[model samples]
Target: MNCRKVQYYLSTFSEGSFSSDKLSEVEVHIRNCKSCEREKFILEEILVAVRSLPTKTTPDDFNLKLFNRIYAEQNNPSESYLPTPESSWIRRPIGWVSALATVAVAALITMVFLQRPVGSPDLPLNSPAYSQVESTSPVSTPSGKHVGNRIPVSAYENIIGVSGSASNYRATNVSQVRTLRLADARVESLYVEMMRRLGAEPYPNMLRADTRYYEMRSPFARTGSNGSPLLRNAASTISY
Candidate 1:
């Protein structure tokens, strides 16, 4: 038998569990091979030492301690599987990011509301001003000519047709008035465009002069003539 085969059967031989034929073969190998004989002797010495050592007995409360540990784990599983320090540190930054995002959203909403103009509504083209002008009583000129209230005439109209000097002056005044109206219109358009882009309401001062004129003619005018306290309060609120 080879040394490997002898060693393989060595434990069975020590226990008297090997067949007689295999035992005889292992003994022959160990007797002839010095390495096998030395290994056999060492194994026998180890086995003897192991058998000579005292066997340790479990404590009477060992089962109780194990049962208590299992019960505690079942009662509070989270305590047993608590997050590590590194994981907690990583989560803290995420919480801070969420808080910051919430604060930023709130601030943006507040800013939008602050920028919004109060009580601003879209103005109609055929508003009350045009209607008022159409409904006004007609005025008659000195030459028995009746003119519509909607037509704006120059104060120098009589002289405008009579002399070149008056005509040029009238033309210059009309041009200046047209230029001023055009400039105001341009400014109003720009202000409206800016309000639209910002999602904000238009300011009261940005309204056209005709619109303001008609608004003043409303029954709710701030002159305190209508004897309405509500109108007076509303006018006071919007005066600035």
Candidate 2:
């Protein structure tokens, strides 16, 4: 409220140590009182001047020179490296408990690492029977309904009916067609053949076969005031 209190709070305010309550009180006093308002303005100007002051970097050899002097003092038996009575408390051991705790943690970590196996855990993905089938069979499918150089059983129904839907969907994501799986190579060839049969313009990237996931780009996502999609491309699934 007074000049003394305001002066005491000035340093705290600069350090950002003032609570909301104290800040509110200071604001109220500064608003009502002309002298306090002038003091606050002066403090603000002081802060700006302090912040604008050119910062000087320490000399490169500063630490080297300081440590050299300390080492020289330590080597000389006649000269005492011990702290004076005024600063003796600082030289006394204080953090033995913290040092012991750090040592314990390091020891535990070392022990655990030494006990660990050399290689990563081999967690097999499929059963032994499935793996045997995968190794021996020419074509692989989990359902065991091999088409003998033909399409998979589940994909049989989709083959004939896919021409129109594939055309529409492929048109929408022609640029990203490179992300189809190796098995989808047959699908790509089929698409090309169907396009020729149906007298349709073939998509440039339609028959691309690179083993990767399809990255979907949606047009119906929400936008900001500027009309750009609020969310960028994200890994999401669509049931349909």
Candidate 3:
């Protein structure tokens, strides 16, 4: 009923495409709006001219030539006129630059790894390399596996991402570790019992897993916390 809708349907209205009620709505809008009325008049004139123009047939050889070109491409791929995918990718400046950069980074990583001449890889943390670590206390993990608290200095790198000697790293500093193992075990048991009141075991994953254990190791931190909790853990870890 609006001028916009009337102008949009003017061609269809000229062709008598709408039902009686819709036709009446469009006609009413065009008659009341002078702008829409002018649009309708121009549209009618164009349609009349189009209907009066002569129609021409396409060339009979057009389809045959198209088919022949497709057949030739199939039989002789190198002779095809179309641009190839591999050539097109290399032709674009951005694509070739990206490819070159990726290859350079890969080669750099391979050379660094192959040429490494630093200290030997360290033992696992639980191994007995922590000098003066006179005792070890076994702590239970969430999955019921036991791990030792005698973390050796050489267990991990002095600088995690750096490639060099372990002299600064192999110096021992850890002295003690305390954990609420009994409390966590008791809490897990209580939770299982409570959820089982529904006459079913708590779906395997619903029980508490991670338990609190704090280690007293220090020599100075390698990273800063920046006051964020996530960065706090990584940044707070102190070692030789």
lDDT of each candidate versus the true structure: 0.45, 0.40, 0.42
Query: Compared with the true structure, what per-residue lDDT tens digits does model 3 show for residues 96-202?
Result: 88667655654654455456433222222342322122234543345664444533323222211121111112231132111122222223333333333433333
lDDT of 1 by residue, 1-240 (tens): 777888887787878787788878888888899998888788889999999999999765454344445435533555777544434533687768755764565465445445544221122336543343234465443454554442232211211111111112222333333322322223333333343343344433323333353334333344456543332332332211
- Candidate 3 lDDT trough over 10 residues, lowest sum: 208-217
Q: What is the lDDT of candidate 3?
A: 0.42
Candidate 2 vs candidate 3: the lDDT winner is 3
Which of the two candidates, 1 or 2, achieves a greater lDDT against the reference?
A: 1
Worst 10 residues of 2 by lDDT: 231-240
Off by over 4 Å in 3: 1-5, 15-20, 29-39, 81-240
Q: What's the lDDT for candidate 2? A: 0.40
> Candidate order by lDDT, highest to lowest?
1, 3, 2
The local lDDT score (0 to 100) that residue 106 gets in candidate 1 is 46
The TM-score values for the models, in the order shown, are: 0.25, 0.26, 0.25
